[model samples]
Target: MQPTLTGRRIIQPPRSLLVRVRESVDFLARHSPARFAILVFTALILVWTLLLSLPISSHARSGTPLADALFTAVSVICVTGLSTVDMATHWSGFGNALIFIGVNIGGVGVLTLASILGLVVSRRLSLRARLMAASDSNASRIQAGPVNEGQAVRLGEVGNLLATVAFSALAIELIAAVVLLPRMLAHGYDLGHAVWYSFYYAAMAFTNTGFTPNAAGLTPFVHDYLFLGALMFAVIAGAIGFPVIFALVRLWRQPRRWSVHVKLTLFTFAVLLVAGTIMYIWLEFDNPRTFGDQNAFDTVFQSFFMSVMTRSGGFSTIDISDLHSSSLLVTDMLMFIGGGSASTAGGIKVTTLAVLFLAAFAEARGRTSMEAFGRRIPRDILRLAVSVVLWGATTVAVSSILLLHITKQSLDIVLFDVISAFATCGLSTGLTQDLPDSGVYVLAATMFMGRVGTVTLAAALAASTSRQLFRRPEERPIVG
Candidate 1:
C-alpha cells in the first residue's frame, strides 16, 4: 500500500507550526545577540521567581510573596545584592543554592553561558557565532568593513573573547574558593558548611555581588583580614573586566603593547581607588561611630576595603549608617563611578569617566584632539562616554526624587539608595527592607535598569552610527 515501487521519491512533509516557530526564534537569536541576551535574563528572572515562590524554597512553612520573590530574583540575577529579605535567614538551603546558581549565571552572563553551550553543542565556532557571543557579553564591538586584515584581526579577537570570559570567571572563582576554604574551616564551620560558604562567597566576591550567606553577615569575619583580603582580591579581579585579566595573563611582560582601553581603565581605577581610600580614612578618622573606634591596622584596612567595595563590590566591613555625612557622600560618588566596562561590576564605568576627563583635559590645554596611552582617543568614544554619564546621572536623579516622594526618607539616605541601585552596588542605608512595596519595586526596577539599560544603550549607540555620504553646511551655534 505504501508504494510498491517508488519510481519517484517521496517528498518530506513541511515542519509543524511549532517547529517552524522555534526555527524562526533560533534564527532571530543568532542574529540579534543583544536582544537575545535581554530575553534570556528576563526568562531567568521569571523562572527564579517561580522557584522562589514555592513553599520549599523558604525556611518558613509558607512561600514568599510574588513581589518579593520577583525582586529577589532580579537582584540576584542582576548581581545586585539589594534584597527584600535576608538571604541567609529568610530562605532555606534550596533558596541559598538558587541564589548561588543565580550569582554564577549573572556573573558570567547568560549570553556567555549560552555561547559556551553552543560551542560545545555545535563543536565549531564561526565568525558569525563569535560576533553574536561578543555582543551578548558586551565583550567588544565589531565594525563594518571591507574584507581586510583589520577585520580579520577583530574577528579573531571575538573568538577569544568568549573563551576569555568563561575561563577568567571560573578560574578566579576557583582560586578565591581555594584561598578562603581553609579560613572558613578555621572559623569553626563544619567541613561541608565551610566548603559551601567558600564557594558561595567566592561566587559573590568575584561577581562583585554583595549577597552574604551568613546570617551575621561579614561582621563575624571583621577581624579576619585573610578572608577579607581574599575577597578583595576576588572583587578587584572581577571588577577589572575579563579583557584586562586576559591581557594581564597573556601580555604581562609587555606593558607597552597594551591597548588604550586597558591603559585608561587601569589608570583610572588606580587613581579612583587610591583617592577613595585616602578620603575615607581622612573623613572617618575621628568619627566614633565608624573607623574612630578601630585600631590603627583595622582602621586602615577597613578604609581600604571600603574604597574597593564602594566601586561596585557592595560589601561593607563597617556599619554604613554610622559613617559621617561626608564619608557617605564620597561613597555615593564612588558607587556612581562604579568599575571597569565589560566587568562584573556596574556603574557609569571607569573608562567612560576616564574618557570624559581626558576630553576635558585636552580641551583645557587647547588641544584639538584627545590622546591617551600614546594614541589618539577616537571622537566616537568620547561621545559615548558623555552619553553614558548623562544617562546615568539623569537616571539616578529621577529615581532619587521618586524614592524620596514614596518613602519620605531623607535626601541623603534616599540618594544613597538610588545610587547604589543604579550602580548595581548593593550598599544601602538600612532602608531597603523597610521600604513599602512600591518603593521596593522602584529600587528593583532601578537595579534591573542599572544592570542592563545603560550598557545596552551604549551598545546601541555605538553600533548605529552612519557614515553619511553627504553633509549639511557647517554652522556655528551659541553655547554656554
Candidate 2:
C-alpha cells in the first residue's frame, strides 16, 4: 500500500486484473442475468466451434470448414439437432465426445446452468442469482414491473428447484439408458458399442436433440416399439421443463394441488399430441412413401411417434419429405408451438399458446380477466405471451424469406426447414444438408435465437425499462 502525502491514511493498491474481471462478471450476473446468459452461451458455442474445427475432431485428419464447425457448435450448444454435415460420419471419437458433453450443458438451460456455476463458485446463491434462476422457471420475473409471486417458483425454494433440475435430468437419462442397453445388445452390438450407443441415444432423447451417433440413424430399430417408446418417454420428460418436473415430484398424487403452470403445460401437451397424431394419420395413411405400406397398428404407432418428435425430439423413422404438403403444414404448426418453457425444446413454448387461447376464450365470453383452475391470470402475463408469440412469428417469417431467396427452394420446403430451425426441431426435409454457407449461417442464427428464447433475447437487448408514473388519456380504437 502507498502512503498518502499527509500520512493520515495509506492508499490501497489497485486491484489486480483477475480481481477486476471477477468483479465485472459478478456485476453482470447480478444486474443483467439475461445478457450474462447470452454471453455465456455464445462463449460456449465459440469454444465448441474451435474444438470441433481441429483435425482430431473429424474422421479424416483435416480441419473441418469454418461454416460446418460453427454450425455444429451452435446446434450442439443450442441443443438443436440440425446439422450441415452427416453427424454420425463427419466427426471422430473426440468430436463426438465434445458433442455429448455440449448437449448436456445446453440441456440444463442457460440461466439454470449459470446459477449452478454461480452456486459452485460462491458457495451460496445471492438474491439476484435466485431471481435469475427463478426467471428460467417463470419468465414473468424478467420484467421490470412488480412480480406476482403466485406465478413464480418461491424464492425460498430456488435451491431446491436447482437441485431438482440436476437430479431429475440425471435420473431420467440414466433410466432411459438402462432400458435401451439390452435392446441395443439384442440387436447384435457388442458390449462396448451397445453401452456407448445406448447412453448416446438417452442423452440425445432427454436433451430433445435428434443427433444419431450411427450413420444408419434410427432405421435399424425402426420396428422396435419398446426402444422407440423409451425414447419418447425421455423426450416428453425433457420437453416438460424442470419446473413442471419439480412440481410433479412434490404433488404427484394430488392433481388438485398442482400449480396452474403444471396443469396448463400437461393439458396443452396432451391435446397437441393427440391432435398432431390424428392429423398425421388422416393425411398420410394412404401415402405409400410414409405410412401407406405399414399395417394399421404400425401406421398409428408411427404417426404417434412422429407427433412426439415434432415436440422437439427430432428423431424420425421415415423421410420427412415424403409426407403430404398438408401434413407438413400440420407439422409446421406443432413445431412453431414447440415445447414447455425452460426446456431443452425451443419455440414460443406451450404455456404461451395456452395463455393466448385462454385470452381468446375469455374475450368471447365477455369476461374481463382470464381464469384457469380458479386462479385469475394477470394482465402482465398475457402481455408477455403476446409479445413472445409476435417475436417468434416475426423470426420465423424473416428467416423463411431469406432462406427461400438464398436457396431458391419452394415455400413449403423452405418454410418447413426454417420453422424446424427456429423451433430447434431436427426433423428436416433433407434441405439442411444441401444449404450453401450463406444459408447455413442464417439458419444457425435462427437456432441460437430460438434456443435462447424470444423473451430472453428481447430482455437482453433492451437498454433500460422506463416506468410511467401516470396513465395516458383513455382512448378507444376500432374493434376487430
Candidate 3:
C-alpha cells in the first residue's frame, strides 16, 4: 500500500495474469499488423491440422496421416487448392466443413477478419487499429508524407475498404450460388445437395481456391459452358482486387475518376485474359489430348475458361496434363503473372508486371520518370515491384529444383507444380497427387510462404524504410 498526496491511503493495482495477457495482445494489435496476420494464420493452420488429423475428418478406416493432414490444412489456410489426396473421397462431412471454414478465413485475410471482429467487439476500430489493418490490406505501401501522391488511404477510408471487401465477397458469392444452384439441380444433383455444391463452388471460385466438393471435380462440367461462365464471372470479380472494386463502385458513372492503380489493373487484366484465351485456343485447338475431341463451340468455351482459371482461379474445363508442351509453357507464364494486387488471387500480382513494363517503356522513350495516365509512378513503387518479382521467381526456381530431385519427375511437370504452389494457383499436371510425402511437404511449405511472403516483404520493406539524413556521393555505373 502507498500513501497518496490526497491524504488518503492508496492501494496499488496488482499485475495479474489477465492484465498481462491483455497488455500482450494490445501490444501486438498496435505494433505490427503484418506480423499479427502471420501469427493468426499460423495458429489457425495448427488448429485445422489437429482437427483434420482426427478419424472423423476422413472417410477411410484409418485417420489421415499427420503429413497429409498438415498439408491439407496449409493449403486451405493459404487458399491454395493443391491437394495430395482426393478431397472428395478421402474426407467426411465434418472434414469438408472444416475445410470450408478454413477457405473462407484464408480468403478474406486474417487482418481483415480480425478488424471485422474488432468492429463487432468494440463497435469501432481506433486510429492505430485501422492503420494496422490497412497496412496489411493495402495493395502497396502508402508513403508517409505525400498528400498528392495518390497512394495514401485515409484512416476513415479504411473502414469503408473493410466493409467493401466483406460486402463484395458476400454479394458475389450469394449471386454465384443462386446462379449455380439451379444449373446443378438440372444437372441431376438433388435440391439439398445442389445447394451445398453451389455455395461450395461459389466460395471456391470467388476465393480462387479451385476446390471442388463433387467427387468428379470440374470434369463433369467440362462441356457445360453456362456453368463455366458463372464460375469465371465469380473468379474475375474476386481476382480484380478490392481497390479496383472500390474505385468502380464509387465511380460507377465516371470512369475517368478512377485512380491509376484501378486503371492499370483493369488494362493489364483485360490484356492478359484476352491474350491467354487466344494463345490457349491457338496452341491446343487441334491437340487430340485436349480440346480437339470437342466441338468448336466447346473448344472455344473451354479455352476461355482455361485462360480465366490460369489467372489464379484454379478451375479447369480440360485436363491440364494433356496440354501440349507449348500450351504448358503459356500456362506457366500466365500462372506466374497471377492476378491483380490485394485480391484473393496470388502470384506476384498484375500491378507489378504493369509497373515493370511502364518503367521499361519510359526508359526506352528516354524519359526520366515512369509516367502513366499523366501521373508519375514513384521510385519506391518500382523498387517494390522489382523485389516482388525477383523474390517470387527465386522461390519458384528453388522449389522446382528441390521437387525435381526428390520426385524424379520431368522438369516441365515439376516446374509447373512448383510455380502453381508459389503462385497459390492450384492448377496441376497430375503431379500433385502422385508426389511423395516429402514432396507434398515441400509444396505445402511453398504455399504458406507464397501467401505470406508477398505481403510481408512489401510491408516490412515499407515499414523499415526511412528518409536518409545524409546523402552519399553520386556515382554512375556502366550501362547494361
Which candidate number maximizes lDDT?
A: 2
Residue 242 in candidate 2 has what lDDT?
86
**What is the per-residue lDDT of model 1 for residues 1-480, given as tens digits with 9 covering 90 to 100?**
243435687755666899998887687566555566667788899999999999999999599998899989989999988888988889999999999999888877776677777777887787657776665544334333232221112556755776777788888899999999999998889999899999999999999898898888898899999999999999999898776776777789998877776787899999999999899889998998888988888888999999999988988887889988888899999999999877889898998888789898999999988888678766766766777788898889888888999998899999998899989889988989888888888888888778875757455445444678998999999977
Cα lDDT over the full model 1 = 0.82
Clashing pairs in 3: none
lDDT by residue for model 2 (253-357), tens: 998988888889999999999999999999999999999999999999999999999999999999999999999999999999999987888878999999999
Candidate with maximal TM-score? 2
Question: Which candidate would rank higher by TM-score, 1 or 3?
Answer: 3
Clashing pairs in model 2, backbone N/Cα/C closer than 3 A = none
Overall lDDT per candidate, in order of appearance: 0.82, 0.91, 0.84
Off by over 4 Å in 3: 1-14, 142-148, 458-467
| Candidate order (TM-score) | 2, 3, 1
Compute the lDDT for candidate 3.
Answer: 0.84
How close is every model to the real structure, measured as TM-score?
Answer: 0.92, 0.97, 0.94
Clash list (residue pairs), candidate 1: none
The 10-residue segment with the lowest total lDDT in model 2? 1-10
